[model samples]
Target: MALKRPLSQHAQIIFRAGVESVCGDRLIRDTVQFGPTEIWFAEHCVDRQAIDRIILVGAGKASGAMAVGMIERYQADAASAGLIQFAGHLNVPQGCERIPEHLSWPDDLTLFAARPAGVNEPTSLAIEGTDRILHWVSEATPRDLVVVLISGGGSALLVRPADGLTLADQLQVVRQLSGGGADITQLNTVRKHLSAVKGGRLAAACRHAPMISLVLSDVLGDPLDLIASGPTVADHSTPHDALEILNRFDPERSISSAVYECLNQAEQQMLAPEAMSNVTNLVIGNNAVAVDAAGIAAESLGYNHVMQSARRSEGTAEEVGRHLADMTVEMLRRDPSRHHQDALITGGEPVVRLIETSRRGKGGRNQQLVLAAYERLLELDTSEPIDFDRLVILSGGTDGEDGPTDAAGAWIDGEVHRRARHLSLNAADFLRRNDAYSFFEQAGGLLMTGPTGTNVCDIRISLVDRLN
Candidate 1:
């Protein structure tokens, strides 16, 4: 049986193309190569004979695939460079590796199950895995080459609570900040201070071993210190900054006393600048790379007036969605007959603050954003009727997972609104309860794409066809 594509086939194709272009495997293959006597990674070339060992250590959603790519590349050149041995440990999301049926990992390489599938919260297993990573780094000699694969979700996968804080304490802090609508920078500020391995501490453990970090950035701007909380990079953020963020996000001080104490003591105990001298952090891929590819794909799909969103795409999902919708509507109204079709592309991770309710809701930021946009478009209909059949709005996570739901995101068109009305569903009510996932499921608006093996945040594309 042939698989069926989604109704929004062009949008789906553009998104998939963009994500695959930046996937860990492809990124590694593009930036790393082996020569006769030297190995080239990014711009750095190392003499294979001079290096005694290559140690891989890190964590993230993309780290496992990145490691696999690195291993394969190294093995391809092993015949020429037999002097260097590759080994180490990594913490990756469960079921990330698509191991071949006949082959298994090398005995020296250790891969640990860190986080469960689709759940970003850290677990006890992740802490144990992080301990092994720290231990491996501690044993590295000056002749060792540490290749760190850091990406989105590393902050959770590489879990090691500060000395005074327990796993439970860290979990509580994470829950409070996440549910409170804290952004990545604020969340990472607290995380770096509360962890023993974050904020250059992982590099510090190497004890002067040369380290190269190939980072697949999920954060905006690719701030070296914030991507995965900068385990292998120098952090200028202080304990005072973490304390301030906690006060702003956790005003009630719901975090455990141990976490508070750990942050308070972080000022004096944080890793010194000199510890990061041997570490080099490079952002091999990011949201802009994904968005640029998306735009190119959109252009190829015959979107005559494609525009990329200028805003940074932060704030509540609902607000961002409404803003995008308004932008689309304005573009169409200004020159409805000038272009046959238009596309507006955006990228960034938005936050969703759960409504206070005893009942749990199923949805993610992308779903909420699209649902809210639908409500806004309905409002616009009252003032000036829109061509219901011509507009399509889609928002999806680049990682192929959104919130706790299996769906990557949702798509909203006038047809979806009609379907919701036919089913007697209220979009505003669903938004209030944070139940966009349920609403979309009934309206046929949910977007599902199983694990794309990459993470760079979310992408939103709004399509307008005035002629239609």
Candidate 2:
């Protein structure tokens, strides 16, 4: 018999495979190709002869890498370089600005730091970056073409307040909504109403110029109108929708008069502006792509894998974690008369509801989810004693970020679980205080990968031995 590899190592490989499949740097080039006189997005082509310039404008964690891909195309394709000029701006979190060692930071295309690393909220710098993008789009003529690279984190990276609202008011409202456990759709509905650029407004800014938005979807079911607040896609939601969501989260209406007033005023404006048809919004990558690739990786590693991607919000982090734990127990206790290994891969984003307490500690949704799973594993009762030696579970953010922490996510196996028990760690205590990072740090199951150059929600892997 061949010696088996560590399940932890296998989980990391599968997770990384998922990230690479949707990597912005690779996805962008794969979607667009230079064919003599045309640039292709799948089958749709833009004529190089008619283009005076190629304007790039975007904001998100993956946009920086997509921008690099564009630059690479410009350098490698003689048709693109000779026929069109490239100029524009991108709003990205810090560390995303790192480019290949061989490439110099070009003057024409600016990759602005919209917000600092680890912070997921809108900042003053984000507002500045948004303005520059708007200006660049405004400068484009009918002869020029615009390519907008969008991905997850664009909501925080691209910021513009509606009339009567300051950045602080917008931030407070969003934070409160998130803390209240509102899903991305509800949160983005509010954000779109509060922004001058989101909800098809960015497409409206294109005016007469031809625009194309390549989106890497992070929202469930790849809802283009909700991902990054749909800056290029038409808004199907209304200000009333935004108001209702806000009310659900904050019945007291303590989000300040400015927020409500802005929503009321937004009713006068059209939801999908007339210029919405001018832009073509394409979902170039999504969670399913990552999940499918992860399954393939699992199969290659001598495991039989099944995959799923949630089409809607899977509820709170704890709920999803517990569900995953239940799945793991079933797998661990399954009949394995046949000689094989079993693996399950899933992708979707889960919410983390913060409890208001001075004793709260630091952690993200992935960490919280893993901790909950750990606790569930300890509490479950099996007909026979569960042998977890060959079982492993992991949940990670494809963007290499989970909330405000440096770690991407976490993993758990028999060895790590035994370690936790040996240390007399109470998983429930860490979970209640929302401090999974501290628990995992000592328990030895934290998965840290600074930034993986992609974003497509979250991917979770569960592996078990099904040996004869």
Candidate 3:
């Protein structure tokens, strides 16, 4: 059956393009769609017979699906898949064992799941039950080909303390750094230093067998060492950098003794000649692939657009929003009499600064950017009369989620302030509280799309000259 493109399908198409591109036929061809098993085959099956036995272990939000895909792909017979599905408490090298844990199918739950175990939502413990999984991996011999599937959330999912650090200590530091707004690269650097499965240590463990990594990236620039702390990849971050991050952020703060000891061991152990010789890494998906898919979708929709540089993105969501708005305004100003419609495209992650006050409301980076741009536009109108028809800025998280809200973001337009005014909602108050959800709901700007089943940070689209 052919799918129909609706009037507002441009946004929908772009969003789906970003998500579906990762699992497209070229990528998932014969695999069981996507799962740990599929990843295993992609990495190991290339030289199947020589590889006597295959050991698959992975952690991530996409780990389960990726694993399932692997099971359906390479194994010439159902025995391999069946073996994985029925493995006991753990599976050793050449044995197939599907880990019991998994990140929530979607992202918001995955994010909230980071809350301490026993809290309201899913906890880090619910995903890859790392401690148990690793104890099994520790038993593998050099003859096994250890295949690791890594993606976002892999770090938390595969949690295993180095020597003495407790899970509690790991969680505390994770919470502090995450809430403190450290970037993924920095957070993962510290995390890599304090764990058994991170910072190339996992690769170090599989020294007996040739190891291959199949990764799905969530880091902005796709730094292998930063994604899931580069479990099976060589790490370049130094202990000095990790300690500096902690001291600079909280001088009085001290990591658990176990963490300190682990850091010391990592520095010494990582330098050994035999530690990382057998490892190979391949990063198959990222925001660029998603962005290219979006660009293709836009062209298919008959809209012209140039891919923007996500690498140059900086500052808070609003600042980026303003920059987007400025670029948009200038683009429109340059040709107020444009005879055709065009879309501006960009994809990347942006930072969101949660206000210190308790009044903070629901909103993600995507929605906040829209809110910020609207606020700026309104402020601009007060000093000078402006025309805003036929112009709208669309932004949202690729996963169909934003911040802690139901709506990803919105189709922000000039009517935002007037609509909010009519509803007696204070736009400034909403922005101040970081409450973009409420503002957009009242303004009828919400761009809701259910779980897209993929994560690549944020996607922004500016629609201009709609009917020119």
Candidate 4:
């Protein structure tokens, strides 16, 4: 008989399987290819003979690996070597800017650090890099085949504040909106209005060049126009849309005066959405892909798995966490030890409305989520004592960084809860202050995986052990 692995180990394996499936480099290899006759971008094919230059520009965490994959793909096809010139720029988070030594890292293609390692906001470096990309794209002609690699974090990684609005002003608007509980779409709607390069402007600048955008979606339902603020896809949203979101979030009229001025200008200056450039946007990977991959991994691990990838927002982090905890409880109620096959996998982006307090603790959405789940277990109203030894429940960001913390997210089990009880920690106290990282630190369940080099939002796993 085989020794059954720990349920925690099984849960991680399933989660990692999902992350690895939609890895930027792996997705690039799977979706892009070079041929002697033509180049393939997903289902679309382009005649190689007609293209003279391949301009590569991207912004996001996964772009470095995508650049590496592009280089590898180009190398693998010895037949097409040196037939066309390849050059461009990429704006990535700090650590993702560097390529592995194993690949032929080219000088012509620039990989720039757009933001600090832990901070996920637009920075001066991001603006400079965006400048380079705009310049590079503007230089492209009809002979150039432009490829834009877009993924999560691209919105912050790619930034050029609109005229008359300083970076601080734009950042302030975003900060106010985020603290007010604005969803990703609403936030990005505002982002598109505040930026010079975002919202299809990047592609529109090089309207003469045929552009292909490879999108790795972190947003729910893969709305191409909203992902990474839709640099390559046209924005159908009006400036009125942005102002409406601001008014909804900041009803007190506290947003920067410059932001309001900029939006008013954009309403008059911005062209009709239909008048923008034509670019083919291809969604190469997303949360659904990750969720499906995780289900396969569970099946391979000999567990009966059920999967769900959220098509819409799943509400607050605490709410989603409690739901997962309830799911685990319902599954446990069925007494799965006799059958030995129960695994639940879910994927989606959850909102984290930060508590406004100077005493607030540090944590990302994933950590907050798991902490909520732990609280739910403690609150369960059951006559019989719940079994803690046979369960593993976890949530983590696919990019391996959750919120502003170093942790990808966090996990919880009966053993971890016991440790918390022994430490005399109050989960509710921490939960109210938005500090799950502190609770998990003392409880021994913080999931720390630095920068997975890919982002497809978040994945959660629930696993139960089998009787041998």
lDDT of 3 by residue, 1-468 (tens): 111323234666676676687641224344322233432434444444334445666665554445544543544354443333211021111111223243112111112122231121224453245544454456656545566666665666666666777777887777666556666777788988887778887777764667777777778878888887887778788887887777665556655666666666666655453587887787777778888888888788877777763753356787878878776665555554453557788887777767754777877778888878777766766776545654567787764667656676786665654577688877678877888887887787788874444456677887666344
Alpha carbon lDDT of residue 54, candidate 3?
55
Measured on C-alpha atoms, candidate 3 has an lDDT of: 0.62
lDDT of candidate model 2 versus the reference: 0.87
* Tens-digit lDDT track of model 4 for 1-468: 332567777888888999999889889988888887789888999988888878899998888778778877877774764466789999998788777777766668988888987788899999999999999998988889999999999999999998888889878887887777788999999999998889888987885788899999999999998999999887889999999999899888887888888888887767556545558889999999999999999999998888999998888998999999899878777765455668999999888888886977989899999999888888883555667776788999999888888889889876687899899999999988889999999998888777777899999999876564
Extract clashing residue pairs from model 2: none
Q: Kindly report which residue pairs in candidate 4 clash with one another.
A: none
lDDT tens per residue, model 2, 92-166: 999998778776546688888878788899999999999999999987898999999999999999898987789
Q: TM-scores of the models, in the given order?
A: 0.94, 0.96, 0.79, 0.96
Worst lDDT 10-window in candidate 4: 269-278
**Candidate 1 collision pairs:** none
Alpha carbon deviation, residue 429, candidate 4 (Å): 0.6
Worst 10 residues of 1 by lDDT: 1-10
Give the alpha carbon lDDT tens digit for every residue of 290-320 in model 1: 8889989888888864545333438999999
Please identify model 2 stretches exceeding 4 Å from their true place: 1-4, 79-81, 381-383, 466-468
lDDT of 4 at 53: 79
